[model samples]
Target chain A: MRAFRAQAAAELRLTARRGDAVLLNLAIPVGLLVFFSLVDVLPRPAHVAHAVTFLTPGILALAVMSTSMVSLGIATGFERQYGVLKRLGATPLGRPRLLAAKIASIAVIEIFQVIVLVAVAFAVGWNPSGPVWLAVPAVLLGTAAFAGLGLLMAGALRAEVTLAAANGLYLALLLLGGMIFPLSKLPGGMRDFARALPAGALSDALHGSLAAGGGVPGRAWVVLALWAVAAPVAAARLFRWE
Target chain B: MHRSDHPAISVSGLVVRYGDVVAVDGLDLHAEAGQVLGLLGRNGAGKTSTVEALEGYRRAAAGRLEVLGLDPQRPDDRTRLARRVGVMLQSGGVYPAMAPGEALRLFASYYDDPVAPSALLERLGLEDVARTPWRRLSGGEQQRLSLALALVGRPEVVFLDEPTAGVDPHGRVAIRAEVARLKAGGVCVVLTTHELEEAERLADRIVIIEKGSVVAAGTPAELTSEGGDAAARGGTGAGGGAGVAGVAGMRFGAPPGLDTAALAAVLGAAVEEIEPGQYRVADPGRPATVAALAGWLAERDLPLADLRTGRERLEEVFLRLTAGDRGGAREEEGR
Candidate 1:
């Protein structure tokens, strides 16, 4: 337990110190939230009354995925390459605790991301009507799903490959996974594929809970739950220490 | 059942294979508590593979291996033994963004009882750069920080791979002193190094591996003496007469074209002009032999430039052992 805390603290320090991590996980997400909310840019969906109202939930979802998946995955890949993972593997901290600490640090970072994005959204004249209680499960499940995928890529691929692949996936999911624009905006086949993706499911769940005022969507919950469980299990089974 | 009674490390018939190529082949080694076991080998001779297997970083292809009397590969043993063993890898175990103090503290937290991080840094001469990021530190500084991390855990058995490789001479002395301290504290150390002087100075026992097998194993004194004896007997082996020529001969400098036969008859040992104005007395340690040589030089008014008795150095022994078997294995495979 002591080792876990120390490892998590170290991970957080390292993440906070890196300029790129700040840009990707915290700055960019908040920047997107402010940019899209203030500008009349995105084509609002038929059911949505205000652009800020619709985009807020999606931006929050984007915050979760960016911090937990893209940034975490690339950083972990480099950690593995640099032998930090191997060093921890030889310690009493072990693999499981090392992973738990990484997850905990990601969750802590996500909390900060949530606070800043929500504060920014409120300032932009956004109002969320749905039971805000549902957002908790959506954010936690979304973080798990994305963090799992991130660790899987970090562990299985080379650092350079993981870096390129993570960036590519983040962009693809941002456009097609209903973060910036709704699934209705994507083409027919892409909408179906997007719904199956964890990114899309998370966005749908957050949007349903926050903007639409309907309880968390049942289908989004199921999709996200499946991803949350499967990705982490697969990552655990496949990860290589070195 | 006592931990102190068991060998700190024990390996029997250990084998490690990468694809079809066998790296460590039927190797056996042991290191006792408080002993510094120097593992010496040529490139690709399986030293790293053997150390990795023992450290639980690599799986053994075959045979038995135990660290601190427990199987290193077993999950339960891995967790239990981790606290008891510390490993310093060849490179890259620290995050580049982390400060040296932070990295040390993080690793120190892994053990129930650990050396203080600040003290370790100070001892390793890293106090000045305690807050410096790993990538920003010089290569020698990074190496010292790695060493500090390994020792912070207060491990019972430590495996250091090239611990002084890039360290400056001053840093090297500090590291050697720390290693000596570890030995005094009853920490078993197994180090692999290219520096023969380090091995001779620190190791209580030395093992030289060739082609995945130990070709020579003994104390520094014993190995050097063996090489000296071999040379004295005129045996033509690897490193044959290379540096060992000093072991069986008395080297002295004087005018060339001397009457060596007359000198040999008087000294009761063969005397030969080995180089221009240089002479070798076959056995010069005897008082009579030295007296006769000095008397002869004094009588001839020949000024003696230099004189010394022969004792083979460790390098001669290492080269003789490793060099002799290099081609023998390949030729056998070809045949």
Candidate 2:
């Protein structure tokens, strides 16, 4: 337990110190939220009374994915390449603890992301309704889904390949996830594909609580739960240390 | 069993294979507590593979390995093995942004009782650069920091992978001192290095390996003299094996292809021109033998350059042993 805490703390310290991590994980989603809310650039989804109402929830989902999946994956990929994972594995802080530490640190960063994004959303003239606490479970499930996918890629591929694939997937999900544009805006097949994706499911789930007319999102919950469970199990079974 | 009775590290018929490449082949080695064993082999000679298998990072294809009396390969003993063993990889295991101070403190946290991070920094002469990030530190400083991390856990056994390979002279001295200090504390150390002199200075026993198996194992003194007399009198079988047999021979520059058979007759020992214009008298034992060589060369009107005669240097013995591995010691084989 002590080794786990130290590893997590060290991982967090390094992540906080990295310039790209700060920009990608914290600045991008928050910056995009503020930018679109004030700029009147969004296509404006149907029945969304305030632009901030829709944008805030979607951006929070983006923020969670950015930190939990994309950022974590890239960092772990490089760590493996540098042999840091290998070295730490040889210590009392074994491989299982090392992984748990990374997830713990990512969870911590996500909490901060939520507080900042939510605060900014409130400042930008948005009103959340209908079980706002439900967003908490939604965010945690989304974090697990993305984290597992991120680790799956980072563990199975080379660092350079992971970097390219993760960034590519992040952009693809950003447009398809209804963060800026709803899935309805995408073409027929593309719309269905986006809805099936974890990012899209996460965005829709967050929208159920943080946006008006919020209610239980049964379909989105099912999608998030499947990915939350499946991706992690796959990553655990297939991840290679070297 | 008592600590002295059970060796700190024991391996028998160890084999490590990567696909079709056999890295460690039927190797055996043992080291008692407080012993420093130098594993000497060229690049791709399986030194790292052997160490990795012992460290439990790589699974052995065959044979038994025990460290601190625990089988490293057993999953049940992983945490136990980790707590007892500290490993220093060759390079680049640290996070690029982590400073030496942070790395030391973080790794120290893994053990029950660790050496103070600050004290380890001071011991390794890394105090000045403690705040500097790992990638920004000099190569030598990075190496010292690696060593410091290995020692921080206060492990009973330590495995160092070329600890001084790229270090500067001053850093090398500091690392050597730390290794000596570890031995003084009764810690068992197994370090892999191609640096022959470092082995001579630090290793209680040196194991020279080639093709994933030990070719020679002895104290530096014993190895230098092991094959000497046998090699002189038409001994040693086949290509390029141990040179610089026990006693020292006078090697002086002269005409290539000297009549060595006649010279050996006169000196009552073996003589050969190991290289063009370089002659080796296998048993240049007495003061009179030295005079005889000069007199022999003078009578033949042959010029002599440097006459170096003493106990054979470890370097000479090392070259002879490894030369065979390269398949280029035909001259030594012919005689």
Candidate 3:
């Protein structure tokens, strides 16, 4: 366990050192959150309810998308191309620990992402009532769902394929994921597909916990759990640790 | 039961096929303890496939293989064998992003007992680049790092596939010295290379595999003698089926008088008797002829001259033996 943790820490440290990881996973999400909240480009209610409240969880979801999918896809794809997976495969560290370490590091990064987003939300006068505890499970579930799907995309596809697919997925999920707009506002097919997509499910779950005050059991929560379960198993079966 | 005189690694009728072309065909090899067995073959002469099969990396199509007294095909047994075996592949590249020392340490964690990274690095002259990332290291440095990774585990049997493939003369000498060190330490080293000089300097026994089978098998002197033209020109019918014929082409300076009768019986009458104390057998098709000749001479206390077989360097020897087949094999494997 100590060895696994050390490896996990090392992987995380390496990721942190990469300039692009910081720019994409941290800076981009935070910058976008601040930019979207300040800008009047979106249809607003005269700045009364404040756009930051609705935008905070969505920005948090975007951060999750970038880290769990885009960043992981790019890093793992390069690792594969460079024979990092082959080197590790020869060792005693099996697939389970390798994946576990990657997931754990992302979870750690997600914590920092959440804290920063929440700080920005509070600065913008965003407040929540009736128990903040529910938000923790929602965030955890959201993380797991997106991370699992990200690993699947990273492992199964070719590096070039993953890069293009991950970028395309990230952009599409951003707009249709209920992060920028409510799902009901999207077209019929897109709304239905987004409901099933892990990113959309994560964004919906987070919005429910933070804004809806834990009043309703959201379909997004169930969707997130199901995907979280499926993507990991599929990755395990299909992942090529070249 | 006490440890019998079993081969360190044994493979019989081993075959490996990728699609239509067979990479390894009915190959047989055995390396005993306390000796370095040089597996000399050309590129695509089934060297990598044979090594991979023995290392339990590639599944064999048909063969019985025992590595370190355990079947390599069994997953549990193979893992156990792997723990005791050090394998240096020709192309298993290190992580470019990792420092040399860091990479060594990471690999060290896999084995239960590994030599200290500092000591290994120092031995391989990699101490200067210990902190350097793998990509920054030169070709020789990279080769040394690869060798260090192979030996760090302190395994009983080390299979080195082209240890000096891309190394310069200095690095080659260093690697040869390391192989000598391993041999002195009582490690059974299975070395594969295209350079026959490396084999001559290091191998206690050299086996040349061509077209997926053993083309020649014996010591440097033995192989050269068997492959020499001495027996072919004489046509003396000295010893026919002896293992010596496979490598009877290169004959070294002869020793004193050796008994011809017993030698004939051992080498099987196809050997052409040269002058006193010398015998030449030429049969490229036989793998047992050289052993037969050696047994005949050994049975009657006769001193044999220095013998050479195959090419002086494994690469030349491999080219001479398997060049014809590799061209077609390479073309087929390209797709």
Q: What TM-score does prediction 3 earn?
A: 0.79
Going through the candidates in order, what is chain B's TM-score?
A: 0.79, 0.88, 0.71
lDDT (tens digit, per residue) of candidate 1 on B21-98 = 777778888888889999876666778888888888878999999888899978888888888888888787999998
Cα distance off (Å), candidate 1, residue A49? 1.6
Least accurate stretch of 10 residues (summed lDDT) in model 2 chain A? A208-217
* lDDT tens readout by residue for model 2, B97-156: 999999999999999899999999998999999999999999999999999999998888
B32-73: candidate 3 lDDT, tens digit per residue: 776899877656667878887887767799989987788877
**TM-score of chain A in every predicted structure:** 0.96, 0.96, 0.90
lDDT of 2 by residue, A1-242 (tens): 88899989998998999888899888998899898899987886788877788898889888888898889999999998888988887898887788789989998998888889889988998788777888888888999999999999989999999999889999999999988887767889998888889999988888887766747479899999999999999988888876
On a 0 to 100 scale, what is the lDDT of residue A224 in model 3?
83
Better of 2 and 3 by lDDT: 2
What DockQ number belongs to candidate 1? 0.69
Better of 1 and 3 by lDDT: 1
DockQ for candidate 2, please give it.
Answer: 0.85
Clashing pairs in 2: B225-B246, B228-B245, B228-B246
TM-scores vs. true structure, each candidate:
0.87, 0.93, 0.79
